[model samples]
Target: MSDVGDRNGGNDLVRFEGVTKRFDVAKPALDAITGAVRGGEITGLVGPDGAGKTTLIRLMTGLMLPESGTVQVLGFDTRKDPAAIQAGIGYMPQRFGLYEDLSVQENLDLYADLRGLPRHERAATFDELLAFTDLKRFTSRLAGKLSGGMKQKLGLACALLKKPKLLLLDEPGVGVDPISRRDLWKMVENLTEEGIGVVWSTAYLEEAEACDRVFLLSEGKLLFSGEPKDLTARAAGRVFRVSGIPGRRRQMLTKLLDEDGVVDGVIQGDAIRLVTVKDRETRFSAAGDAEVTAAEPRFEDAFIDMLGGGPGGRSRLAETQRSFTVEGEKPVIEARALTKRFGDFTAADNITFDIPRGQIFGLLGPNGAGKSTTFKMLCGLLKPTNGEGRIAGFDLRRDTAEARNRLGYMAQKFSLYGDLSVSQNLQFFAGVYGLHGAHKRERVDLMTSIFDFRSRQSMSAKVLPLGLKQRLALACAVMHEPEVLFLDEPTSGVDPITRREFWTHINGLVEKGVTVLVTTHFMDEAEYCDRISLIYRGRSIALGSPDELKARVANAENPDPTMEDAFIALIQASEEERMAA
Candidate 1:
């Protein structure tokens, strides 16, 4: 490992001077931004989906040029010497282009060929990357067959094939689990120590907090540029923890968020973590029999505040939602020994769970862990090879149409027609869900108003901003207002404020007695669920409330455990048990 700075003859790898980029939109993708990335340091590009993080990275890679100012990478101007800039940097996009049909080794070799590595250097480079990514054992495995985490590691290895001076990773942790995210961070940190400058763009604030320096952008403008602590200090005294009745945390959170002085509130463990408006002393009376205590602020708290705080009022979408009524006292959703197999491979193994009405039940698992398979079976999208999946007491296998009619599903990826307008998409989904005539038009209008899509209703769904797209997808899912709602990674890459707004709507729906079944990679969002089932290797490994799950991993060394900690611990324990058995 040689010092990248020494080879480049400079510490500053990338520098922007009043850079501006536009893409025929109302706003510039990046507007007059100025920042610098130094060797041996991690520079974090933090922002919401349309916040220009990706645009900035593209400028560094010379894939796109700035409209006005200049972007210099490794002493070469992006506009003048893009080839030199590109040759001096390693870049990985959000969706790393890995050939699904190729094996892990084949993908690595392909990237090596593309990078033009010498024949003598090929063996050493491949060996180092395989060991670094811990992909040696999976060398012969098809890239498509690897888990989400493994795929990310393989992508990183490909990005490093040329061993450039600067590395730019754009949202590398998007779908990766906590353990794998940690591993990716470790890999990046190791590169920094070797004097390779790194730019990490992510919506996850926790990762931003760990960066040596961060440039927080919003709507193509730089909100702040400094150490993460400088930003965290902005929300210092305004943060509080409100603990109330054990089972009433969600209700209390809803009320607390509506308070005049409160800026944001979220469920954290058994309490509601709140951020109040700065300089306001408005007292809160919503937490009955609860204690209010000052709490430490984190990067997310500051990030939300900087973005004008979260949507603090009740969800308008929930207000117009019709209350769903169940006929009998049976569970709203039931999965009894549900199993799905493809030939000899079992994707889901006898998964079982029950959800009563008005509950948010979370189905959590790492990628390729069979949770998705089980969810599809329950949604009537897949036929179960064994056992039953029932909704409102109707068997999914026997009464597929009836079971599907009772549920509204939002897939992980935006499934709406991109070419259609917002209004068209709404009408289409409403029709698909059995809405007709006046009711369909009324529901479409209501969703437009509720989601604040009045001015953008005629805009193409593909061209809308990421947050708006998310809102449209959500509105379409609930247009018919089914008894059960399914959200799969609904807020995957959106910013913190958008996520808060989305959850506010979900909480409102649950309050109206709508049953929700959600699957997410975000551990914090798992706190919103009344109960959770963690699956690993196609088996249910743990089931409990957030606090109960955290308790399973608590010990003297770590008295308090976060949901992520519990998730990683439970999965490790399960793997160890299997090995021993």
Candidate 2:
């Protein structure tokens, strides 16, 4: 569009002139890309994983040279004067280097010294940074002890110590909770207001809405670039909200997905957000009684539509899999008064919840709020200082081994053997679960086909892409066909389409009597859960269905709240009540 083109040697804060970069024999990471960022505005680079977002940020920071074209930063040629370019820019990588042994103030002083700030100037700069980041109270605490959100804020403070002319942040909030993400964005907005240019990259489409200009990149190509509102206009009159019977949601979703003109369907708070191929009236017959209504298009809807629906992949669930019904009135999993402590500090305090058979349960909270502590206690990996838990009717404390036999756990980091072949890892996990001989062969073959990894079975797991890695991890976890599944941050770094595919498999398992307990930073994914428990500072703050949680936060101003809004509102309200107490 008119928003992006040849700058013609203009003096923009940063400019990419047909820049191209490659690694070894692979296709160019950035292929003839050109863009400009002004001094007092925010520019967002939005794309999927491996879309060269990180590479582009590296080029701008003078970490790597463009092979053919030029990249200018603050009027200095990146190739000829890399140091000069780096001097005027601040860069925050996805994984920044912070000394765990150093205190917060020590880290800040080190960065200031490296940047050569005078002692007189250092006092005011440090004061401003510590105040802005809300880290003044924790200045003497070790950086390693800070929460994820505080760590990010500390990095931002250090990057700004030199009064950077331009700032580059690469996926700063990828795994951060919604509240931390909001704080980071608010700080970025403040930076832009002070006349510092910013070029940020993110896989989250919702974040793109905050940028003044956004560039949508896929497979190293710029598909669309313009104002956020202008890009969303492309999908006007093309989105709808579908409502159906509560228990029949699974069946309704399948039918809509199979419809001809349907682009995609995802579960919102209490409805299915449906999108069509184009801006026209199309037909969608609900398999049951469901109502459809025209709705406003979100930035996510437009991005998905503009990218041609989604990442098409085949569903490979077993055709002969039988329908599963709950066999009893009692819940399949339960945790009673669970509490975990480290010495004198309580990480998880008196937490309790239950999940019925064939239901999806979500545990949501901010970083360092004891989600992992609770997860570990329920999974029987760690001993609870007090209380007890049960899985598949087996006691977590008295019969840990028996309880473990009927459950599967997938860690947040996808603990796969990177050096081994896909089939090898599957075989190893199968052996661990006591599958042998014909049964082992059958299970391996079935999992291989179900995840559509048969063709790449011999490939090393490390060589596979992020999406494939995620699929393989999930497949390996479910190899035992356990009655309960535990997924922690299951969709963290992957893109939206892959996330949808992953959830589809989980949904099918729910139909097969498998109970799931999941945690996620993405609030949209929380909508898929039958019920959710909001956790904060080692306690359960609220528990309800997705619609119930949203209703609790809804009012005249935002009567129909998105999951993010509901989460923030509830969290803020909880904080207020605690302070009042």
Candidate 3:
């Protein structure tokens, strides 16, 4: 039995043979899974939330046992020598714990002691980790005060305290700023080069693309496993971009989806992106107003195609004929010198910005740069210490209630009631938005149909998949169909397919004159915004369209820069300016 687990002894770091796990009255979390995680390479377990990603990780770490078959870690049976396996592996769970009360150095010291490292080795390890994580200057700062990205780095440093053979990261980039995410990935790659085995589990397919090998999972079953390019080849020559969509985008989208061989279609900018069945032959014309051209298939395009295509009939949540009515010529949202202070510590400093009606405006910044503070002030959730803002011509300070009524808000955290069923949550939100009688019924029906929540509406919102929960939150927020919507990090942790669909719906709303003020850590998603305000140290440093901002930071070395490159350059420039001042 022991040697049976050693089937791939040469390179396999972890192995599972027909392993299965199930919770009471639930489907198997890992259904007879068989796989090998190789040494000295990053193996990405890519799947949507509730697809048993964490369960598989736990099984490998000996944190959980399979009902049948075997799990081997470092040549040890997880069911027998669990502690020995744990001692030799560094597993960073989805929630990496950091002592909030401890200072940066103190936290490192604590982890060092917990890992039982030699006293002589502690100092050198701490120094190396601190320099690598870029936390040398923040040694005296409390962990509680660190930004989300900083905390993630600190967690990683602690995880590396003992230099274990394998490092497991579960969704490390969730809610993290783009730069920090890139830095973290670089660190992971560096570790791989050192002959360390790394297993990364993520819902974001982009992150999976970085791994040497990927195992795509769905409902606890392995769908595809091999090189990333092998997966990309699944939908090759079937992806396309249709631009010059003149008008009636909703109709055009629906028309494309309904067309034969068209598996999925989404509105992107003034174009509609569509995916067709690779072998199916069909040419589509959206009212003869759009031009279609074949585009290269990305990893996500293949993933969606593998999933039997996108949600066809129930792809939207907003009403078909919905149109937001702008109140006056002035922008729907205006913030003049908006400032918020926690005592002498300025959370948001004198931030001034204007949001025009019917535009998808983005508020982007590093974590702890006070993007949330600015959102709260603008949404009437927090009072500005000095400056004032107005929503739909209503003063945020004076007419807070009326201002809130004119806009929809989906918080960064999924803030809906956990124990409530999906239908109940939607119904409650409709009532909160003043829907009643037939109006409430009509809106509830639309929410159920658009988000495809009808089948599982009776299930608790807590139990739904992360993507479905996000859909529910968006549905609840827009049940009233307000003139403006404010979303903070709305697409964080969402899968690429769902994120694309979500943005497609947002684009449709913007076309109908519904203004949106949103924030996201995904730079590619930032490209969808009409204009963006780049915040740093609570100040609006740069504000422009994605292209304009990209051009602002472009150099001879980087002629055609991405939004991420532009963002990093601008933020670095801002830091330099602050230091010189």
Q: Which candidate number maximizes TM-score?
A: 1
Per-residue lDDT of model 2, residues 1-581, tens digit only: 11111332443688888988888456878888988887777889887767788888899999899898898888777878889877888988877567779999999999888888889998899999999999999999999888878888998998899888789998788778999999999999999888788988886778888899988887777777789999888778888888855565755676677787778778775688888887456777763567788899888888887767753222455232444565774788898999999998899999888999989999999999998889988899999999989997899999999989888898887699999999999999999888999989998999887788888999999988778998888887888888788999988867787788888788777877788999999988999998999899889898999999999998999998888998899889999999999
Model 3 whole-model lDDT (C-alpha atoms): 0.84
Runs in model 1 with CA error above 4 Å?
1-10, 325-328
C-alpha lDDT score of every prediction, in listed order: 0.89, 0.84, 0.84
Q: Judged by lDDT, which candidate is best? A: 1
In model 3, which runs have C-alpha deviations exceeding 4 angstroms? 1-8, 24-26, 244-255, 265-272, 287-291, 313-316, 320-322, 325-328, 419-424, 435-464, 553-560, 576-581
- Residue-wise C-alpha lDDT for candidate 3, range 1-581, written one tens digit per residue: 22423544777889889988998447888788889888779999887666789889999889899999999888889989999888878877776488899999999899888888899998899899999999999999999888889999999998899997788888888888877888899999999887788999887677888789998888888888898999998888899988777765555776788788988765443456788998888778553757778877878778888877876633355446377745567888998999999998998988888887778888999998889999989998998899999998999989989999999999998899999999999999999999999999998998888888868989999987788889999999889988899998888888766786787678668766788999999887787787889999989999988879988988899997768888888999999999999
Q: How many pairs of residues in model 3 come into backbone collision? A: 0
lDDT score, candidate 3, position 88: 79
Count of clashing pairs, candidate 2: 0
TM-score of each model, in listed order: 0.96, 0.93, 0.89
Model 1 residue 506 CA deviation (Å) reads 0.3
